[model samples]
Target: MKFWQSVEHAVTPAHGWAATTGAVVAPVFHYFYGTGRADILVVLLVCTALDWVTGIQAAKKQDKTYSSEYGLSRLPRTMFFLALPALANLLDRVMATPGFLFYGVTFGLIYHTWNSLTANAHRAGWPVPKAIVNLVETEIKAKTERAMKQKEGK
Candidate 1:
């Protein structure tokens, strides 16, 4: 009976892959987030996904070019930025610091990504607030100025 059960279990196929994967990942997630940080991760992921979908729509509408290759080329950067919160969490652990840097940088990235998503949505013909768009432009201008100054100094 035990041998038959073992064989049955083996042949039944694994429905627990997702569960097993989550179990494996749970420790790593806890190691970084400790607890109560799932919201940050969720927001970042949601923003990234919306941004990509809107990006495709915007490109198709405005540029009339839906190039998967171009999108794929940009994917690494998108993924890296998306993963910055994990780096922040790791930094908090290793440096024995308060999680301010983690929250600050991650929330900032989330905001920036959401802003991009909104811009893409607006371009794709959705009505986004003018103020929101203006804010994005202002931030870009400030960043550009800072970068220009750095270039000049160099």
Candidate 2:
């Protein structure tokens, strides 16, 4: 108990940042890994890391000052994207929709993952062709708009 208390004291966040993160992520991590679905979590973690790293690289490559302010703005969005699929999966189970919502959301997550990766690549001056970038951007926007319209219709 003393050792645990000492460890807790050492690792505690000044505010609630660390605790909040653990509370949100730990259960998901446990559930996936515990059920031998760790590959899903691993893929997600890898995508998240790559997105952040490339985002930083892009910022440094583009911005003369490279302030952390812009970077901080992305964290909440990243956290939201990371959590969205899991929530959709839970909803699928609750609704008993035969994987429809889960698959749809998972596809969206993966599409957005690649889209972000492509954007980061372009921003980092990776020679992404203008035509391909435009095409993908247009398609993604259309798809997103369709989803929004459908949601509104419901």
Candidate 3:
């Protein structure tokens, strides 16, 4: 067997798999986020990862065993995070709202995840400043209130 033939044999399957995955995933991503919004997803994913790491550290700090089951529990929450924005984007399109619902839902999820990350870091004995924590809580509260008011008005 020639060296180039072996190389092609090894790479071809991986390339096909990647291409197939991209074909499916790219359309779904564009459907949900359109264009120029992947940063939102990236940030949310990064925040979730940081939160997971901090949660593990926090569990260790408290002398608790971090279970794989607990880690796997994030799957549903992550799905919710993704689904909410997609739903909101659909609503925005239907309502002709120009990305308002999508951005709001995505940012809200990001903020919530950030809050969780900070709490986990604090639990892990990190010196998470009180002011930062308070600000997050305050913004969450304000957003909630505003949303409630909007709902009431409607």
Top lDDT hit: 3
What are the lDDT figures for the candidates, one per model?
Answer: 0.76, 0.66, 0.77
- Candidate 2 regions exceeding 4 Å error are 1-37, 127-154
For 25-69, candidate 1 gives per-residue lDDT tens digits of: 999887766578888788888998998998788767755666677
- Candidate 1 scores a C-alpha RMSD against the true structure in Å of 7.0
TM-score for each of the candidates = 0.75, 0.58, 0.73
Estimate the TM-score for candidate 2: 0.58
Give the distance in Å from residue 81's predicted Cα in candidate 1 to where it truly belongs: 1.1
TM-score of 3: 0.73
Sort every candidate by TM-score, greatest first: 1, 3, 2
What stretches of model 3 exceed 4 Å from their correct place? 1-11, 63-65, 134-154
Model 1, position 28, has a per-residue lDDT of: 81
Q: How do these models rank on lDDT, best leading? A: 3, 1, 2
Question: Model 1 — TM-score against the truth?
Answer: 0.75
Worst 10-residue lDDT window for candidate 2 reads 29-38
